[model samples]
Target: MKHPAFFKQFLITICLTFFLAPNLEAQTKRIKRPKSSVGISSVDNYVRNSFDLYDKVYKYDGYAAAGTPLDDDDIDVLEDALDDLALISESAPDILSSLDGQNAFKKAKATLQINKANKALKYSVKTAKELLAGEREREKDDDDSSESNENSDEESDKNINNDNSNDDGEEEPSNVSDGLEVYSKYDFVPGDKILFFDDFSQDFVGDLPSKWNTNGSGAIVKLNKVEGNWFELKAGYRLYVIPDINELPEDYTIEFDVLTSGLSNQTSSGARLHIVLSDTNAFSNGKTHYAAVTLPLGQYAAFNINAYNHFNGKGGMINSGLTADIRDEVKNQPHIAISVTKKRYRLWVNEVKYVDIPRFIEELDVLNYLKFHLYGLKDGEERVFIKNIKVAEGGVDLRRKLLREGKISTNGILFDSGSANIQPQSLGIVRQISQVLMQDESIKLNIIGHTDSDGSDEANLKLSKDRAAAVKEALVNIYNISADRLTTDGKGETQPVGDNGTTDGKALNRRVEFVKTQR
Candidate 1:
């Protein structure tokens, strides 16, 4: 019935801790939102509110980076602020980008601060969430110390039904180390042009994503056992949650990560996570046609691919047919990749291609939008989550572009913000580039890295150079490309291919170019 109002009267932010149940049970309270003068755009009021959260995140990073934990009360308030910021980002992601390249002098000064804050936000959020989860667990122990073991065992039993995991009463580890070398044979090249990308970082922990429409219902959720925000889909027959992608071009690639939770030995074999590509973006399967790729959860279950109401082609695991643990992927989190080039369709779960049909689609330009269908699962008892849904266009050959044009610039090669660490998935573009060098011994390249106008000019330049070196290292070590045949450089934020104000524009500006060297 009582609360202390810190920092006089400027109470600005708080996250609803309702979702932190079974672990943390903190009461919702206002946090001190520091005043910020970072005017990102015309919306001064909006920018101030976001920068306030950014300031909090900046301080949290200091606490976490120094290996220091926050007091319980302070940590709770910070968690609330993060939740609030996530909701704001869901609606207006542009607001999250403080530097819009509006005024040259002002933009340059603000970008340095904004970029550092952006990088810190991620580290601080993870540390704070982990602390909150610890607090929640401690509270649970205090509430009922006697029943702790019993409750944990019961929770583990609800994990997975694939039968690969014995009822050992241990939860799966959160951090997964799925390496890249396994994907050496994986040739699913992503589109050169970005279409739609949603890690659900913009959405609040318990709200529906801003870029999706569903006939049934689903919520964006954060797991204590795992990191990142995931969309937990509710199941029903013919129910679909569709992303707000405008249309699918003739050639494009789609990639997303899937993880399963709350399954047991009694789980039904019929439960499956269905991915549908349809002509219309609405709640219905196309009247004329729709293509589907189905991933089954149960062991000895068939994974299916079909062109709705036309034909179905499938590959499955039956008794005595498969040897690998089906439960490993579902629990450990698996990456799914789909590449559609006109009539030809190819789908891969991790590195393995489940479907590759030359004439998978009857028509080339029929499929336009994306739909997700979850079939035959108890909503509360069994749960499935999907994150990092990326749909991009133009997976065309790059060898010709190098020879005919003497240069290749691609947005497909990706890295973390202001970091040299390249994403494992982005290697597909690099793989193609390496082929050109392999085919002809005389070929040499200058790998140049670029970045969006986020951080300071100096920091961005160093980051870009480091990223270029990382790509070159990958080529020499992984693809066996010679180090002597390659040179590296970074353009930083100097070259602007797209407007820094919008999301798509920023994605375009952050690219890697390979230029053929004149010997």
Candidate 2:
């Protein structure tokens, strides 16, 4: 049965709120809420609407207060009520921002109303979320289908494909999970051959991405903080966004970067960013054979990140609700890495390996496509964006290649656009190679850099030389390799491995080569 657009948004909203709002009763009891504003009727309505629900919550006891689960019909009613609240959350800022105080009374009213709205939003959001979480425990227990049971908790992904934001890079950096040195054990590696790569640079802002298909709505956006373009993901129940990458070999890796906002302890949790591996490219979740890895975004620190998987049409279970708590790291823009090697599956958030399971992926060849499914998040309130998605064939063992062939050329080393500055994540490749130099004191290397044919030949030539010099610098300063042991060279775009006309081709053309020589 096809659901109206309204119902689809409810899918993840309730689930996220289920976890985000931990204590509703205490949350709703604001010590001293001020009076409503004089000129803003909408503000008054928001307060009244939230208060009505608040009254019922305290009156008959909340979903947990009275010690009983709400009926299925009641759950539907609450969902409908949440829809109205979401609209109020989006529109309230506009209404409140427009309020001007021409006089003392007017200014006082503005201040009072702002306080009222903030408290009401917090209380009401908590009430709805906690009720959803506390009430639906039984429902979750009874539910067997993979649909509702997905381990998802994200701030609404409603901004990826939308270009309507006033964000400049001035906002403080998101709370990044610290101590990356602990994640040195991150073992997943990308494939050597590029299959699909997109940074959204080819797409225009405020337009839907050209190479992606979605049953829901999203658009391309450029932000002041992050470099390049990103796709804003809209939220809906069971809504799937399928990328243009069509074929996936049995051994391949998927990597992407994610950014989020409007997540806090006061907000509700409602969606999971579902990275799915399917047998078919259709809109459905591939009923016959599929594997999905769930990512919970935008939750409070009290909750641990959960990894839930649906394998071979619900016939098996490897793990669910693992204690991989990345709530802090996730909100701070983490580089996500996933590798599928034959039948094994592994995932890492930033530098930490969070999940690894043998036999988790049942059929390696049947998983041919990749897609994303997300549930409810209020439009304009919560947001998630993604960029730099690379799907490549399984990588060769570079260490082995270096020892055997005396040289290794790789595209895994990345740099900032239009510059030779190496991205922090790209240091992993360098770190691995540095180990090889340490193990064999007699080995020395000539570092060579190459680029695609996008700029002037002179500029490209100089940029490649600078890049190779940068690699040599990293070997000396960061990895402690002797500077005398390395030589630097640049071929620029003269030596091309793939076509420059296409994304993958261009990605392959930009390479860094390490050639071993006598010390």
Candidate 3:
């Protein structure tokens, strides 16, 4: 069939464009397996292929009419694939480090470079810049392999599991902040009521975090080669807001787990994270009244109030001295706990005390808002990820609360899920109460157990009873408290202190209480 002259010309042009478009053709084609480099580790080869695929999708092709413009849907699909590759590249180094070979150094260098290449393909100009810059700074960070830390997955997991069992064969106490045995050095206690809690489990991958409000952008992401989900900050000067800090109790605790993305060779730079409390609902662009705790790379975590800076000023030095030294291994995540009671503030990182302030809040002021900030970021400064954030109230004067309130309730005494056996992590609080009981030998008490409104009522009641009894047994056998001095009871779900529907609320309702008995 004969076609119009212009139509014929258009058809010929289209054919030439498709034939000459090398980059666009590569993007549309199935990923090609690159020839294996001599002596390249399997992990390194995989990383190289992934980065190569990313380059084909994002790099420009020479032909002017070589590619069709991607629609929003197309962009989204490509971006998702890019994200997967980026995460895999991020964790490839750690996996490579786990291997034993002379090629380890070569693999590590290749792995680091591939990660940089992945970052270079990032879609946004700003985000791409921040991520790429972070990679650049991490060059020195890649020097120390995870092996140098002497912490292998086998060893770290073993430690996490046996945190309760000690070599001495004696039951050591647990940490007050988190339900882990080795954290016995921690003296933190959660508040009586849980104000806010989030694990990021409810959020979908590659979506905004469900439990937070941020002025900038962030996403709930799980590293392709790592365990757990994290809220990754995607921009600078971003504020991560917890919407529930309406009227915080004077005595409360905040806890979360965090890791920096730029953990390379035992050195970290350009990553700064801070927690702030202010009177405003949203953090403003300009100055406002606020108190904050800042953690800078390679230094002690500092606390700042208004104009007084803990690490830089004399007034700041009075309350600052928590050597965080967040280096050695980037993936070795740390748990942070901050407890506040009236004017006093104490913070714990992992099992060690980072700061202790007897009088941080000087007046009748209450921190009505809570926010997290990331700043001082340079071109390769690492990105920070946080998860399992919880804020609880009531840490000061436990004995006073028990006596004055007639009952002292605690979430510290934890048990295995659906089991009556008390976790070894609960020993810390039990020991504390035992010492108090010993100091006042004449005092008689009743231990009561409660559960959230879940499962069958009968089952919950029985679980609660068994848990109460377990607590009593621990006090009697482990602490040598007289059985005659303590009585046990269970309320099950009938006496709930928090909403049954929410995770934090359910955690709150499942607790043990000590009631003073009139002997």
lDDT, each prediction: 0.65, 0.67, 0.58
Worst ten-residue run, lDDT, model 3? Answer: 130-139
Q: Per-residue alpha-carbon lDDT of model 1 for 1-519, expressed as tens digits?
A: 113454111122222222223334322112212122223332333444455565565555444334344554665577687686676455455654645444543353344334433433443455445444432122334335324533443343333211222233322223232344544555778888889888787688889998999988999998865667899988898799999986889899998888788765566777777788777877866555677767667644333333332422222121111223354456557777889888787877666776777676766776788989998787687889998788989788887888789899998776744567665567777888888989888988999989888879998898789889988988897899999999999999999898877666787888889998987
After superposition, which runs of candidate 2 have C-alpha atoms over 4 Å from their true positions? 1-186
Give the number of the best model, judged by TM-score.
Answer: 2
- A best-first ranking of the candidates according to their lDDT comes to 2, 1, 3
| Candidate 1 lowest-lDDT run of ten | 314-323
Q: Candidate 1 vs candidate 3: which has greater TM-score? A: 1
lDDT of 3 by residue, 95-199 (tens): 545345634333334444344434433422322222222211122322243233223433433343344333433233221122233433345665656778776
lDDT of 2 at 123: 52
After superposition, the stretches of candidate 3 with alpha carbons farther than 4 Å from their true spots are 1-185, 221-230, 259-262, 284-286, 296-321, 324-333, 375-384, 412-428, 456-459, 473-484, 487-489, 517-519
Q: Return the TM-score for each candidate structure.
A: 0.61, 0.64, 0.55
State in Å the error of residue 328, model 3: 7.1
Task: Determine the backbone clash count of candidate 1.
Answer: 3
Counted clashes in each candidate structure = 3, 21, 16
